[model samples]
Every structure is written in C-alpha cells, then in structure tokens.
Target: MTGDTMRGAARAVLVGPWSARTWQACAHLLAGFPLGLLTCFTVVLLGGVTTGLLVTFAPALVTLAALLWCVRGYTALQRDRFATLLGVVIDPPAHCREEPGRVRRLLAEAAEPGTWRQFCYHLLAGPLGVVGFVVTTVLWTVSTMCALVSCYAWALPADSAFGRHLHTPSMVIELTVGGLLVFHLAPFVTVGLAAADTWLARTLLGPTDIDRLRSQLVSVTQSRNAVLAAADAERSRIERDLHDGTQQRLTALAINLGIARQTLPDLSGPAREVIEQAHEETKQVIAELRGFVRGLHPAVLSDRGLDAALSGVVARSPVRVRLSVDVSERPSPTVESVAYFVVSEALTNISKHAEVGAAEVTVARNGATLRLVIADAGRGGADEGGGTGLRGLTHRVASVGGSFRCDSPVGGGTTIEVELPCES
Candidate 1:
C-alpha cells in the first residue's frame, strides 16, 4: 500500500466511533475504580455518626454530606462519560430543586429511604473499583517486569518474587509465557470491570417510581403556570377583538341611528322610514354585542361568585342540567373561574357532541380540593383532546393545578370530572 493509504487506514482504525469509545471507557474505568472505592469508604465511615460534637460527630456529619456531594458530582461525571464512551444513559438523583435552605433541604433529602440505599451502593462500588484497579495495575506491572528479562542476564532461574511463586523451571521461559498472557488479559479484565461499573451505576442510581413522580409533579406545576398564562392571553385577545371589531361597529351604528332619528323630521319620504328601520336594527346589534362580551368572560364570575355564575350557565343550557353545589365558601379566582369554565365547556360539549337529553353538574368543596362532576346521557367518547373547545378547557383547568378527565363510551354517555385545589 502507498504511505498515504496506510496512514489513512491507521487513522480510520484509531478514530472510529466505537473504537474511540471503547478506548476511553477502558481508561475511565481503570482510573475511576480507585476513586469510586475511596468515595465508598468515605461514605461508610461518615454514615456511622449519631451525634455532632464539633470534633467528633460534627465533622463526621459534615464529611458525610461532603462525600455525598462528591458522589453526586461523580455520578454526573459518570453519566457524561458513559453516554459518550458507551452510548448509554445514566442519571443522578434529582434533589436540586427544593428551595433556598440548602443544609435543611440536603438533610431532609438524605433522610429519605433511597438516600441510605444509594449510600450503601456507593460504599460497595468503591471496594469493587479499588480491587479492579489493583488487578489491572499489577497485571501491567508484572508483564512489564517479565518483558525486561531479555535485557537482564539474570535469567535468575525462577528466583523473582512472582517467578518463584509460579514455580516454573526457568525464569526466562516463565517470563516469555506470562508476559504474553498478562499483556493481553489485563486489558480484558479492565474492560469487564468497566462494563460492571456501568451496570452498577445504572441499577443503583436510576430514579424510583416515587422519585419519577415527584419530578413529574414539578413539571406539572410548571405546565399549570403556562396554561394559566395562555388562558390570560386568550382572554386578552378576545377582549381586544370585541372592543375593536364588534364594540366599535355597535358604537358607530348607535351614533348613526341617533343622527337619523334627529333628521327624520325633515324627511317624510321612503328614506325616513328606511332610516327608522335601520335604527331599530342597530339597537338589536348593540344588545347582541353586549351579550356576546358578557358570555366571553362574565363579571359575575367574580362578583356574585362561581356558584351563581354556574347556576346561570346551567339555566341557559339547552339540555336540562341539574346543578348541585355545596361550595358555600369561595375559592381563589383562578380556581373558581377554571371550575366554572370546565363545567360550562363540558356541558357545551355534551350538548353539541354527546347528543344527550339531560346533564348534571355537581360542585362541592372536599378538603383542599374543589371536586366537580359533569355527567350527561350523551354518546360517550370524551377525551382531553376531544376537540378544540375541550382541549382549551383542559388547559384552563390545568392552569390552576387542576386535572380534567373525560369518560365517554360510544352509544353510552359522557362524564367530565375535574379536581382543583381550592384556596381562598
């Protein structure tokens, strides 16, 4: 092969994706093993503290917290290392979001059951890491020592520490066989331990269901805020549309009608009667526009309260909707409006989609949650993403730390359930 061709082939073998990953993984395992073992040991000694007496338990507790912090940092490092080197994913515990008081939060987090379990694994991993490190280190050292037999005339006839232990007839013969075997096998052992370390890290450190759900709650809370912001935006857009379009047109129409009324005395012709007819039509337009704006967001939803507003909604539904509410006390405006909207939209869907003859809405305060149930005898199959309206309502409910559930079975009926945290 040409020199260039040979060099290219060499580079390809050295820098291939999996090849580079394998090389780095083997190197990290060899290095991290010692560190992992030391971390484990420190964790164990620190865990035995029962009291803090400044020089005694105090230092132990502080050391314990510091060791756990180091382990947490190491866990992050390993995640990056493993993902890059092995194309595998590993994650650390999520205790970072608990508010300002770091020491208190850390202590609370450490007190959790899983923390102790992970601490045990961290301790165990350190010893395993150390053992693997020493084995690989000794293998390489012994093989190098054996390789130098050719330079030293000290055929030393099985007189070296390792040679005498092997009990071979001659040191040169033993060195030749042992060096070749150790040189090849040492790397494989290190690789095997590296694989083991990855497995241990994943199995021990991955989040449990409770941990996952807790994290999910954090996400849910953030999403709830976004939903609220979107709702506010939608409300603003609707208000602007009404004010600029329908409201402006209604105001202009009213002004034109008033002018026509004053000018009617001068004209007693067909034009006068036509102007009067147009003036009456303008009054109807103004009334309809006012009603439309009220329906979009009623001031009553805030003034007379959710119960009265909801009762008004039930009264207006085409289908007979029986309202049963025991919410004597009021909740937060967001909670009440969301609850009201959920019921209103759900009933609207039932009337339009459910094809039900009758519906029932029950709202009651149960402890910290305001429970709402809207059931109808309509064709079922109701889901959060049922349609644009239902989806919007779902977003509205979620904005206030509330959940929406719709159950509709085909040819059966539909039921919408929602629970919102109620705090006045």
Candidate 2:
C-alpha cells in the first residue's frame, strides 16, 4: 500500500503538464462551440424559410442551396472536427443533382431521398448544437477555474450578463472547490460527448462506411447471380440453335446415306462413289456442329485456364489481334471464366461491327484486381444499346461487380476496359 501510494503521488505530480494539455484541448473544443451553434441556427432557419418559399416558386432551388451549404459544404468541416475530437469516420450526406432544366430538375431534386435527409439534418442541427454548446462550455469553464486555483490564492469573480455581481470571498471559495470537483469528472463527460457526437454525425450525415460497403457487396452478389443465370440462359440458347438447325439437317442426311448403302450392292461403281460422296458431306455437317458448340463454351477454358482459352479466341478472330497476358496468379474459376468471356465477347464485337484492321488485348493481375483492356483500331461509336452483344456484356460485367467502359469515337478506334475484384 505504501509503495503504490508513493507511485500514484509521483504519477500525479508528473501529470501536471498533461493535465494542462487536457484542459487546453477541452477549452479549444469549447471555443469552437459557438461557431457550430451559429452554423446550425443559421442553416436551420434559412433552410426552413427556403423550404417554405419553395412552395411559392421553384422549391428545389432554395432547398438545394440549403442542402449544398449544410451537407456538401459544411459536412467536411463537421466530419474533420469529429475525427479530431472523437476519432471516428463519419459518413457525409449524399448530394444528388439532376440535369439543368427548371421544372424537371426541381421536381427531380425534391423527389430524391437524399434531399429530405439533408432537410432533416438541418432541422436537428440547431438543437443538437445548443446542447453540445452548453455541455462543452460549462465543463471547460469549470476545469479552467480549478486549474487557476492551484496557484492563485483567491477565486475569480463570475460576471453575469444581467449586471449581477458575484465576487465575494466565500463565493470564490465555494466556486473554486466546486470547480476542482467538477474538473476531475470532466474527462468522463468529454468521452461521453465524443461518443454521442460520433453516433449522431454518422446517423445524420450519411450511411455508415460499413453499411455502404455491405450494400455494395450485396449489389455485387446480386449481379454475379444474374451473370450465372444469364450463362445458363445462353447455354440453353446454343443448345436450341443446334437442335433446330444442324441436328435436323444431319438427321435427313443420315437417312439418305443409309438408303444408299443398302442399294450399293445392286448399283454401279459410279453410284457407290456418289453415296460415299454424300456420306462425306454428312460428316462435314457433324464437324461444324462440334465446332459451333465449342465456340459457345470451350472445355479448354476449364482445362488450361484463361490464357489458353483467350488464345483460342484470338486464333478464331477474323480481325488481327495482338494478345498480351501477365497474370501471375490464377483467380477463382468463376472470375477467370467471366473475364475470359468478357474479353471474348468484346473481341467478337470488334470483329463484327468495329470495322477495324486490328485489336489489342491485355490481361493482367495487379494485386487483388483482374484488369482487362481491349482496344481496337476500328470505327468507333459504340454505345450500351448499340447492339444486343454489348448490352449482354454490360449485364454480365455488372453481375460480377465489375465495371465495363467502351470509348469509341466517330472515325476513331474503340477501347474497352473491365476491372473485376479477385477476392477468392
């Protein structure tokens, strides 16, 4: 007990400067209180009046201005302060805007969920700021008086706004003692305030970071599921194509060849040779079916990986292709397959519609991302709805949480880039 007591006393004596810092920081935090108060009050009152006036004129103009100032402009300031004082990353408000046109844009802005959220934040800021002001100011004043009392023999006088006098000796002693007592408890109160600030900032400003990330993950998962569905749908389509066209032709050819084979014994050598020729034609039709099915889904993509699968695509491409791959690590089967299909489809588009001489394809893995860049020196002007192939490719990429961009200008070449996360 004696040793512990001595250690604590030494620590307390050493805590003098640190205690000063703590009080100083608290004071600085309090000093900024008035600014927050003014900002909150001004924004709320102005926002309310603007919203009311919006009903008379264009409601979106004034409300949008208020939102921009309150959230987009001031959010950074508030978030930075929260991080410094409370050590938290608060989400900022989502600022949504529409293309310029008076009535259309105004209606669009007013209809958005984010605008309403900004208005709510504006309304709440005033009351929240007032409470924060009182707590911070009171705690800071008390801590300062207690620290001043450590050296000064007399207590300081309290000046009132209403011309009240409060400088008696007994009053000084009581207030000084009270200040010292409250100062000791200031840290706990400050910690509570910081936590409240973090919570409220996150709730009012925008969605939490974790929440945003989770929502993104959900979207990715949904899109990937869509891709899988689309793949199955595509396989069924290819199967139907074969069944309806090549399969029927081959069946008729088989019946003819069988009948010729049975009559070969009674026929002349020339007749036998003709049946043999027809059999050869039937074999060609079967070969074409195999090739077409392979084009739809190559087994090599599963066996040899994306590099070899893409090589096959290049060989079949009508346009000259320059392929470069620097994938050091193998991605998950699904991801690699999706990426290969994306590149293949893009190259196919270039061959069919780009009207270009040559195309370049580069696939690489930089960290956990799989990057595919395909650029063609062909006629540009590629748009999302330009064709069914590009449209399907967009949905496929989106399904895997990947982004697809095609920059094809008139009289210029087309360039397509896709980035997919390789998490597995």
Quick one: best lDDT, which candidate?
1
Candidate 2 achieves a global lDDT of 0.70
lDDT of 2 by residue, 158-222 (tens): 66465544465565566577776576666556556655655666776776466578668877877
Q: Evaluate all candidate structures by whole-model CA lDDT and list the values in order.
A: 0.71, 0.70
Model 2 segments more than 4 A misplaced: 1-32, 59-69, 94-106, 147-150, 154-178, 208-214, 217-424
lDDT of 1 by residue, 1-424 (tens): 9999999875654343235554565666676686676766666665545334336745656765776676676567657666776677876665644646867676776676656656666777677767766876787678767766666634445455543633344656767767756665555566677788777777776676787899898788767667665675577468668967888987898888889788669787787888888888888887787667656666677678878888888887888999999987788666776787788778777778877679888999988889999898876876656463778877777667688887777767877788998852
TM-score (all chains, Cα) for each model: 0.65, 0.45
The number of residue pairs in model 2 that clash at the backbone is 2
**TM-score of candidate 2 versus the correct structure, residues matched by position:** 0.45
Which candidate's TM-score is highest? 1
